[model samples]
Target: MATAINVQSSCSEAEWKARQRLAACYRIFAYLGWDEMIFNHITLKVPGEDDAFLINPYGLHFSEVTASTLVKIDIDGNTLDGSTYPVNKAGFTQHSLFHRELPDVHAIIHTHTTATMAVSSVEGGLQPINFYAAAIVPRLAYHKFEGITVHDDEGPRFLASLGKKRMMLLENHGPVVMGRTLEQAFLNHWVLQRACEIQMQTLAMGKPVMIGQEVIDKHMANLSQASIDPVQQGVPEFDAMVRLVDREDTSWRE
Candidate 1:
């Protein structure tokens, strides 16, 4: 980690701040036990850059990520920063594809958490039994799994599956959440993950009590009108998680 720290780069103050937020996001992922070792990724679009995006270095643990260690890459999946670490193939295919096509998306979080993967493998995908599920069900999209995404051909299919939706479940794979900011992405992941967890738990207790369509539709409508700012809706929990990471180790700020 030290070797990668403070490496020479021409990233602007805004981009550098984006790096810090992305790094903190990785740390908070670890804090919440949502990290899956070196697998999975959380990415942010670089401020003021058209094609450049910031992602975690391929081999590092979520806890090991830092502002200075993030790697910048372009739409072509080429590393723009002269870092020793390589970017994950799947990360580029899934993240860069969306960032390139969706002009409004600024951040993305992909995870293979236990509950989320379980839901992905199940029929009907995420359920609408709980408030969390109902709130997110309206924006949910499903993409059939096409093995490991290494080829360029999967790009268009991935984007099409996620068409205009902020949350997607990759069939037999995992869930991906897109947001206008890292804060929003994290919040989206939290809601999606919890919804899956609740569905799994409720199923374990014999048949689950399904919420009615009228009630579920009402909640969905309310969520649509709620504040979109992650800071406004998620700051209370996000700040607490940041504090937890800081207490453990502030290396993520490097």
Candidate 2:
């Protein structure tokens, strides 16, 4: 169904933070070379809503996103068709599962980048080869790739594997990462992308990059503590990113 032309009411004030975070997530992903143009998605679960969330409108590049451009949707993946924007089926299916099943997770990022999808297509997913891998560690989950996530069945398998975890690699498909906030989720995707890059590069080098499990645990633990106040770091950084993107294009916030 085609989407509607207007929201019943303006987004709640609480949603403002989520929107800004979503936009910042775009800039960071672009910086990491992880954005698949307008195909991939970064969605946020609207604060204080029931099975309602926000996603970038269809047909916009990550670098082109702004706080006001994200569209709200229901758990069933409907665009509220009356929304003043449009959505793609890929973003809907991937984001719906996360918003529906992950209670603690407020944001989700799906990507198809060179290194990330490269690692995903392998017999195995990302290998713990660098400091960034520690941030994900045991929390990382993997989903077998079936195709583009357009079917409802993929939703269950994807959500089941992601059960309470923060990161997932959709094997042969791509990567899906989550967070408690837009900032946190964005950071997760960036680190996960970097980890994939590092893993791929190491394999390319053919040199053994021996990483100790204890060291990985240490870094993961440190990040757990640091996330206690992601706003201080994540929120401000998100604002700064929006300003940066705004310099190039402020149309998203329109």
Candidate 3:
């Protein structure tokens, strides 16, 4: 364990790479027009810590984010890295609820994308409609609104409602996903955002809803098999997305 700590502490290069990629994610989401200012958050669990995470500083938009700019904070919202930029205490509430409760969750992304919010506002919540819709997920949680999640008292509901699920539709809000790795979380967010977009656009046509669980499961399995690591597949195009975001802004590297 001590050797591991030394490696983590001494390995500035590796840490820098992690931060750069994470920062790129923030900027890419911002460019995708998914950000709702500081209202939503995307958090990554620290490499080896159990009760710690990295979240956005309150004022910066995702486009301006960089690896170093991300604030390191404990589950209680305490800043561990001496960052002057205050981490969003209220925003941390929902993220903390997940990171603290789920050990498998290394990355958590919360978004306020249009279609997702629209789907969340509906009476039944996300009804899987197409192949994309079928990927909505299994065991999705629907948590009732208790106003903005800032207070610690709200943790129980957040924890209870999430209850070992990857995705949660914040009733009248949007969705949050817990990923075991940064890339997996990113892939999940991509699918979910697309699902919400498709649901919203198609629902406007007044089409029938997809209620078949078997269909959803089938396509979901396909999507899972299709899922692979960006770097592992030699997908230079994956970094292209990061570059696209970097071209827009590089403040995230600070």
* Candidate 3, poorest ten consecutive residues by summed lDDT: 1-10
- Off by more than 4 A, model 3: 1-11, 209-211, 224-240, 247-251
User: lDDT of candidate 2?
Assistant: 0.74
- Candidate 2 structure quality by residue, lDDT tens digits, 9-39: 4666677766766666776677557777678
* Model 1 TM-score (2 dp): 0.94
lDDT of each: 0.86, 0.74, 0.75
Cα shift from native, residue 5, model 2 (Å): 6.1
Question: lDDT score, residue 185, model 1?
Answer: 80
Which 10-residue window of candidate 2 scores lowest in summed lDDT? 1-10
Quote the lDDT for 56 in model 3: 78
Off by over 4 Å in 1: 5-9, 225-233
Q: Highest lDDT among the candidates is held by which one?
A: 1
Candidate 2 clash figure, as a count: 3
**Per-residue alpha-carbon lDDT of candidate 1 for residues 128-217, written as tens digits (9 for 90 to 100):** 888788887878999999998777898888888888898999989999998887877888899999999999998888877777889888
**Descending-lDDT candidate ranking:** 1, 3, 2
- At residue 188, give the lDDT of candidate 2: 70
TM-score of 3: 0.86
